[model samples]
Target: MSPFDPFVHVIDHPLVQHKLTLMRQKTASTTSFRTLLNELAMLMAYEVTRDMPTQEIQIDTPLETMTGRVIDGKKLALVSILRAGTGILDGFLSVVPGARVGHIGLYRDPTTLQAVEYYFKMPKEMEVRDVVVVDPMLATGHSAIAAITRIKATRPKSIKFVCLLTCPEGVKALREAHPDVHIFTAAIDRQLNSHGYILPGLGDAGDRIFGTQ
Candidate 1:
């Protein structure tokens, strides 16, 4: 829970916090950074999907009959916000391999600091599936905002935005733009720097995850 916005969820589990600290270190290698991101995503997935509905069914065990509760993974959709999002996407897939995946390609315009969409695609029957948009950073919120706005047009059953790091400005902007969409993140740092980057934050998640830097 964030004071800035009630819709924002800060996942500060010990494991999440620990890995995040490692990822934030400038000395961390590309290989280690990428690994931590995926592992963090997987850990966060448990809490993100905590509210999912489950149904119990009777099953025959080795020695006796028992009832087991299960969730329908097919009812969920993972929409990655392009290249960086794919890192988080991989972890989520490991948790729910049956989930349908989608992609929305967006890049920030360096000068104006706005999001520019280059590509967009989603699974069929999005209106009936719960969508979780994955991205590593929510700095300006431009990319997440634009991606969610477009996804809303499809009228999905529900939508939740997941990111690794974010700042006050980014969270505020996103909450204002889409109050209905709940935001989940590992940590919320101090603020954004002049170039629209989260300060005291992990640098360019996309770059680090893919070794682009």
Candidate 2:
């Protein structure tokens, strides 16, 4: 029942750690925030993709009997969980240059606090791809769960969840709803506050990214 034990991986690469420090500080400028997110995203993508399959092909160059390599089947689909998730998309794409992209938008109902999907868009043949669902913050995990549920409808070959920061409660909720998901994160914070924000979180991710408040 330890929600933290299942499929959570904290990517602590030196590059990830370094960029995360800049991302957490008060002195980090808006432009700096963007740059850090992009850097961390690319670094995170490197670890997230380590288990991918590869294939070998025989090739002939100036010499003979040379073998080359390439990835196997089902190209990746990067599904952004909307708004804040968009910040990491470009960086991920920069690494997985051939990966497809998708978008899912969900809003929490005020009274129920349940996620309600307002929009979704995916690649034309998304069902055959390996999907990486991304969000910047995993606070309550309501939106992440709902977004994954929606994507599952497309019947992709695999699903992996990626977030910049994950809270314990959010990880629990996500694990319960989608046990097969492999979660990749930079750090796991503690619990959530009464307001549903992750304790010691970087504040509203959308607000911070957009300078809304």
Candidate 3:
């Protein structure tokens, strides 16, 4: 995988790479695909939240009192990009159970390859919470871009985008559109197909995760 952009972080942990290879296999079952995606998300969550602010407080330990660091201020907001994003959301929530959840429903128009939003909802007090947008693929970047554009209206403290896979086109499009937002992905594939799907990607993430294909 090539470095597409500075703001795009390609997670290269051994485990992350291993699981991504498994997910890319053509014969991987729906059960395995979904399971692997959740596990992958959990592993990626570590890097995603690495810079989260923390506050120190004195706490009682088993042996004695000591200063402990905890997440500062309000809980994070994990916004899922509808059905496909829910797969990643599950793993992220398992890591940060106290996080507030939100959803943005969008679908790609096959003819125009544009994102059409049908639903949008978010937790209250977004201004106080850092937002992490989760989706499995960033093929065309349409859905991710549109979703983030709407979320910006709420004015969250910060924003990050997480996807299982992406291509140079996707990364460039998103970076050009939202330079302030960082992107985290397991791999950046060769390129996108004519239909706006990532080449060598693990097929349609939503369809594979749901066994719809």
Candidate 1 runs further than 4 Å off: 1-4
lDDT of each: 0.93, 0.85, 0.93
TM-score order, best first, reads 1, 3, 2
- Prediction 3 global C-alpha lDDT: 0.93
Candidate 2 all-Cα RMSD: 2.0
- Cα distance off (Å), candidate 3, residue 179: 0.7
Point out where model 3 deviates above 4 Å: 1-4, 72-74
Provide TM-scores for the models. Answer: 0.97, 0.91, 0.97
- Model 2, which residues run further than 4 Å from truth? 1-6, 59-65, 72-74
lDDT of 3 by residue, 58-129 (tens): 999899999999984346999999889999999998888889999999999999999999999999999999
Q: Number of backbone collisions per candidate, in order? A: 0, 0, 0
Between prediction 2 and prediction 3, the one with superior lDDT is: 3
RMSD in Å for model 3: 1.5
lDDT for each residue of candidate 2 in 8-111, tens digit (9 for 90 to 100): 89998888988887787766777878888988999999899998877899988886788888774338899998788988888898888888889999877767
